[model samples]
Target: METAFTPFQSLAGGALIGVASVLLMGLMGRIMGATGVLAGLLMPANLADWSWRAAVVAGMVSGPIAVMLVTGEFPQVQVPVSSTMLVIGGLIVGVGVTFGAGCTSGHGVCGMARLSPRSIAATLTFMLATGVTVYVLRHVMGG
Candidate 1:
């Protein structure tokens, strides 16, 4: 499958992520790790913790609606894989996050920004694994 080259969209999204990360850190002293945020929402320690996680999740879910309102239509998404593959990929990601202790938003953006050695290593590993996975899937498996 071919990947879409969306430089402007990518830049905008990255800027938004960076701004959100800084805001979350400044406001809550927390990293804007998507998986951690979701997990906290699912199994919160208290009502206060749950509330912030819920707000963050709500903002995440409503982004598409906000985009639709702005552009008069939802942003187009292209998922070339089957539903089965999507589910499998999600499961793999969940497993990876559990093992790696954080996701890309956390390790790559926030953690690396702070010069955390663990995050740097994790980010490098993530990129390398991603490259290898894509190569294997596209070139070797022809998927």
Candidate 2:
């Protein structure tokens, strides 16, 4: 099925993300990577560090709630797989993040913005892998 495309919304969201990244780096001296922030929360070394990590996680959780309150409806989410499959996919992604040293937001956005060669390579690998995975699932495996 054809999907609805909202260019304005997408552009606005991307701009917000860019601003957030810049602000986080400027004010906190931290990279705005969800995975890294969540991981830090799980294994914080000090109370001060833990507080910001907790706040980040809370803000992430509350973002959809705030949007729903403003819009008078929850955002549409389409999940094409079973819950078990979703959980498995999440676990695999966690493993991949660990191996890759960073997630997409970290390497693709922040790292590339800083002109890191490693991040550029990592981002390219991520895009290529995602494209190959989609091709394999949709055509080769007929998933």
Best by TM-score: 1
lDDT of 2 at 89: 96
Q: Candidate 1 on 1-143: residue-level lDDT in tens?
A: 87889999889889988998999999999899999999999999999999999998998899999989999999998888799989999999999999999999999999999999999999999999999999999999998
lDDT by residue (tens digit), candidate 2, 1-143: 33479998789778878898898899899998889999899999899999988987887788779879999988888888899999999999999999999999999989999999989999999999999998898889987
What residue runs in model 2 are displaced by over 4 Å at the alpha carbon? none
- Residue 62 error, candidate 1, Å: 1.1
Worst 10 residues of 2 by lDDT: 1-10
What TM-score do all the candidates reach, one by one? 0.95, 0.92
Taking all chains together, the TM-score of candidate 2 against the true structure is 0.92
Evaluate all candidate structures by whole-model CA lDDT and list the values in order. 0.95, 0.89
Q: How many residue pairs clash in each candidate?
A: 0, 0
Supply candidate 2's per-residue lDDT for 87.
97
